[model samples]
Target: MTDFDLPEEFDEENIVSKTSIKRDMHKLQALGKRLTELKPNQLEKVPMSETLRKAIDESQRITQREATRRHMQYIGKLMRAEDAEAIQNAVDLFDASSKAFAQALHSLERWRDRLIEGGNETLSEYIHDNPNADIQHLRQLVRNAKKDLKNEKNTGASKKLFRYLRTIDDMDNETTP
Candidate 1:
C-alpha cells in the first residue's frame, strides 16, 4: 500500500512523536546513570533483566568519559526491553528508606531554629521527648545558639546545635523498632 493508503487496522492516535521517543530515551539514559551510581547491593535490589543488569555492571567499570557515555547509552537501549517503572520504584523505595539527608537536615534546622526562638518551653519539650539526651549539653547549645544570634558572623554555635540535634535524632531512629 502507498503511504497515504487507507488501513483499517492502523490507528493514528497510537503513533508516538519523534520528540516523545527521544524524551523517553533520555529518561531511560538518566535512569541508567542512576543505576550505575548505585552500590552493588543496592543494584541487586533494583528489578531489571539480566542483560540490563550486565550492561549496568559493565558501565561501572568504564572509567573513560566517552566510553562510559556510550556504554550508558547501550544500557539505556537495553532498558527499553525491561520494566523501567518497576526498576524505578525499587530504587526510589531504597532511597526513601536511606538517610534521606536533605529531609533530615531541614528537620534538624527547624528544630534548632525553634529551640532558639521558642526559649525554655521548646527546650523542655525536646528534653521530654528525648529523655536520654544530655540536658546540660542541649541547654548549653541553645544558650550558645542564642548568644550567636546576636552576631551573624559566628555560626559555629548554631552548627554545633544542629549537630547535637542530629545526633539525638539519629539515636532515636536507631532505637526505634
Candidate 2:
C-alpha cells in the first residue's frame, strides 16, 4: 500500500528488460549519427509574392501562344488526312519559309534592343540643332526596316523557289509512273 510497494502479481524483470533497453538505445544513437553527418549548405529562401505569381502566369501564357503557332505550322505542312497531295510540296516549302521568317524575327530583337538604348536625349539633341534632322529618326529607322522586311517577303525570289520546288516534286511523282 506504500509508494515503493507493488502488487503481489507485479514482476520487475519483465517491466525493464535489458534487451529492450539496448534496442532503444541503439536506435537513438543511429538517428543522432545520421543527423550529424548531414550538413546542408546555406539556405537561400525567397518567398513567392503575388507579383511573382502574376509574372509567371504571364510568361506561361506567352509560351502557350507560341506553342499554338508552331502547332498550326506543323498541321499546315504534314497532316495528310486533311489530304491534298498536290499541295504537299507547297506546304513543305511554306514551312521552310515560315521558319526563316521566325529566325529573322529573332535577329530583329537585337535591333529593338539597339533602338531602346540609342533613343536617347544626347543623340536627339545633336540632331535637333540641325533643321534637316529630327528626333523621330529612331522611329523612322524602325519603320523603314519593317517595310524592307515586308517587301522581301513579297519578292519574286520566294515565288520562284516555290515554283522550282513544285517542278521537282512533279518530276518525282512522274518518274514512278
Candidate 3:
C-alpha cells in the first residue's frame, strides 16, 4: 500500500493526524495566553478545570521568559485533556461583552462631548434619542460641565455627567430582553 493509503479500520475523518494535534496544541496555548492576560474577575467568568486554572496562575507569576514558555506548554498539554471547545466559547463570550462595554463607553463620551460643545442642537438630538431621559438633570449637568470648562475648574461636572450616562446605560441594559 502507498504511504497515503490507510488500513480498512482507520477512518481518516475520525483519526487525528500528528500535524492536526500539534496545531490544536498551539491553538490551546494561544487561548491559555489570552486567559493569563485577563484580570482575576474576568478570568473567573471563564470555566476551566482546576488544574488548568492553577497552571495559568503559575504562568502569571513566572517572570522568566523560558520558564513562562515551558509553563504555557504545560497548560496547553492540560488543555488537550479538557473540554477546549467549551472553554473557547466562554472566552469568546467574555471578549464580546467587553467589546460591547467599550463601545458603549465611547458612545457615552461622544454624547458628553457633544452636549458640552454642540450646545442646544446636540442636546435636542440626544433628547430625541433618549426620550425617557431626564431633560432637566441632563441640562443641569451639561451646563455645569460647560461652565467648568470655560472657567478652568476641576471638571467635577464632567465626571458627574459620565456617572449619569452610566446609570442610563444600566437602565437600558435592564430593560433590554
Candidate 4:
C-alpha cells in the first residue's frame, strides 16, 4: 500500500497525524495573534525569541491585508520552534492580572457607591474592613460626595472618593502575600 494510505488497523502509538500538525500550527497562529494584541509593556513580560518579537512588531506596523496575513503565518512558523507552552503561560498570567485589576476597580466603585448612599454606616464598615484607612479623609470625601449628589453638581467629590478607594485597594494589595 502507498504511504499516504491508512492501514486497516491504525497504529495507536503514532498519534501525530497530518491533521494534528495542522491543528497545532493553527493554535500557534492564534497565540501569535494574541501576542500581537498585547501592549508594549505587556509584550515585554512574555518570553519569546528576538526573531519572533520583531516579527510581531512588524505585523503590528503592517497595514496591508495580504502582508499582515503573511507576517502572521511567519510568526506561526517561528512559534513552532520556540517554547510555546511558556509563552502561553505568560500570556495567561497577564490576562489573570488584568482581570484582577478590573475586579478590584469594580469593588472600589461598589464601596464608593455604598459610602455615598449609606453614609456613616458604610464608612464605619469600610474602616472596619481596612483598619489602616484614613477615617477623617474618607469621611470628608464621602460627605462632599453626598452633598454634590444632592445638589446635582459636578462629580469632583465622587472622583476624589474613587481615587481614595483605589489607594486603599493598592495598599491592601501591597500588604497581602
lDDT (C-alpha, whole model) for all candidates: 0.82, 0.39, 0.82, 0.86
Q: What is the model-wide C-alpha lDDT for candidate 2?
A: 0.39
Provide the TM-score for each candidate, comma-separated: 0.51, 0.18, 0.52, 0.51
- Give the best candidate by TM-score: 3
| Pairs that collide, model 2 | none
Tens-digit per-residue lDDT, 80-152, candidate 1: 8988987776566446564554566777898899998887889999899887799999999898888888765
Per-residue lDDT of 1-177 in model 3, one digit per residue for the tens?
A: 999887889766787889998898899999988889888866776677889989888887899989988888888888888888777765664575666556777889988888898879899998887776799999999999999999999769999998897777656544542
State the number of backbone clashes in model 2. 0
Error of 2 at 155 (Å): 35
lDDT of 3 at 132: 66
lDDT of 2 by residue, 109-174 (tens): 443434334545534543453334333654455444445456665444333333433443334433
- Candidate 3: C-alpha lDDT: 0.82
Q: After superposition, how far is residue 56 of candidate 3 from its true place, in Å?
A: 1.2
Model 4 lDDT, full chain set:
0.86
State the lDDT at 67 in candidate 1.
Answer: 96
List CA RMSD, all candidates. Answer: 7.0, 28.4, 7.1, 6.9
Clashing pairs in 4: none
